[model samples]
Target: MQKFSFNRRLVIIIVCLIVSFALMTVSVAVRNKRSTPPLIQQFGNDIVGLTDRIVALPANGLSGSVSSISELLNTYQENQQLKKQVGELAQTKVRDQTLAKENKQLKQQIKLNDSLTDYSAISAAVITRTPSSWQNQVVINKGSSAGVVKNMPVMSGSGLVGRVAEVNKTNSKVELITDNNDSANRFAVQITTKSGKTVNGVLSGFNANSGQITMNNITTKAKISKGDKVVTSGLGGVTPKGLYVGQVAKASGDDYGLSTKLYITPATDLSDLNIVTVAVTKQ
Candidate 1:
């Protein structure tokens, strides 16, 4: 019976609080009609605004982070595409340069063919060079099957380079004029003078350090000059006539001081040999 009386008193107190809050809300609404909202209402609105900002803070931050991540991904994709394009451009440049170089080499071969009109030529590519200090030999792609025989003269774009030393079915080795061990490196060369007289000599030795060939056994009565053009004299049955050797650079006495020696700067640059032609005579 005592608990029932306490519960009845609690309910009466809650009813009285509810009636007091209703009277306060009615009074504020009537004052708002006369002018602006009262200070208490403005205070309530400010509190609601503060609560809304607090609620939205985490949502706004998350939105900004997502947007930044999306933009970063897009930038990365664009960067990758640009890198691929740059790689393709580099490859294209290399291809173009290679083609241009090949074209130039072909043109040179054509010019060489026209210059040697007297003899039939067999074009061959240099396979490899001998790995020696003298650089005295090179292997070519043509051999016995292509009519390339031992002692056959070989010429590059500039002039005579060497002669065939060994031959096989599909390849041959050319012994350059600078070879020290080759006994057959000697050539009968002649220089024509301004007066149409020819001076004969033997091209037998080469000085690697000076890049010059020594022409010894020059006849004492022969007249030659520094700028005279030296060529094969066609004395030996192997080499044909009129093949260019070099220009006379200097003249000095031989080691025995008995005969004259002419030093010649070779017409061909032996350092580089890409393509060559072998003179195939009718013999």
Candidate 2:
């Protein structure tokens, strides 16, 4: 009787398993993703209407949460595009600025060439500088090969900057008036102000190390005051006439002899120099 009862239980379990397997198979067959044509055809009109509604939804400036999500994604993509465009614009701006600087420099060279038509202009670049010496000096690109010889005066649009101190075939050294050995700065300079008072003074380096030059040696006969302009005297024929040197800051002279005092300001800001013109051949 026990063996018969066990066999009956086993039979019942087998029947349950078979039924579950059939149900599973049927469920899988019904839920298969292969064919949706029956449902689509049954609700074709509804599907079309829903599709129109989805297509008509505004992604921006909408009040619904779904619309908000869409707007955010759109805004994010737009921001990324703007950032890329801005980066490209920044690069273009840098290139334009560099080109502008070069153009300005070239225009200046042309102007210098136009101003001095008698002499030939050799375009030389500044290779080195020495500010520690009493006279300031700079090496240029042109040398004996370029026909740039020693003692050739270097001038800018403003006036004389210095002279050629050293030279080789492809290079030359320029001695600025601010150098210790340079004699152009040691002589007396004369300034005729707008008021017509002629002020006489010596121009020299302000310090042992600095390139700060000043107009000293004021004459006693001259009525000197602050803010007076100083210029070259054309005495030694080193630098040409009427080059701006400095402005008078203070004045001190003897009662009968020449007056001498310190000049407070420099006419030119030496630090801002980028381009300068040198006279290769001069009369």
Measured against the true structure, the TM-scores of the candidates, in listed sequence, are 0.57, 0.45
Candidates in order have lDDT scores of: 0.75, 0.58
- Report the alpha-carbon TM-score of model 1 versus the true structure: 0.57
Model 2 RMSD vs true structure: 35.3
Q: Candidate 2: worst 10 consecutive residues by lDDT?
A: 33-42
Residue 273 shift from truth in candidate 2, angstroms: 3.9
Q: Summing lDDT over every window of 10 consecutive residues in candidate 1, give the lowest-scoring window.
A: 29-38
True lDDT of residue 189, candidate 2: 60
Task: Residues 1-283, candidate 2: write the lDDT tens digits.
Answer: 9999999999999999999999877645543332222343325533443344354344311435765677787897899899989999999999989996777688797874322223456666655455563546665556665677666556655655666755554555576655555333254467786569775555655643444565545545556677777775655544444556667676655345555655545555554343566554355
Model 2, position 54: C-alpha lDDT score:
52
lDDT of 1 by residue, 97-127 (tens): 9986776688697874322224568898776
Q: Cα lDDT for residue 224, model 1?
A: 74
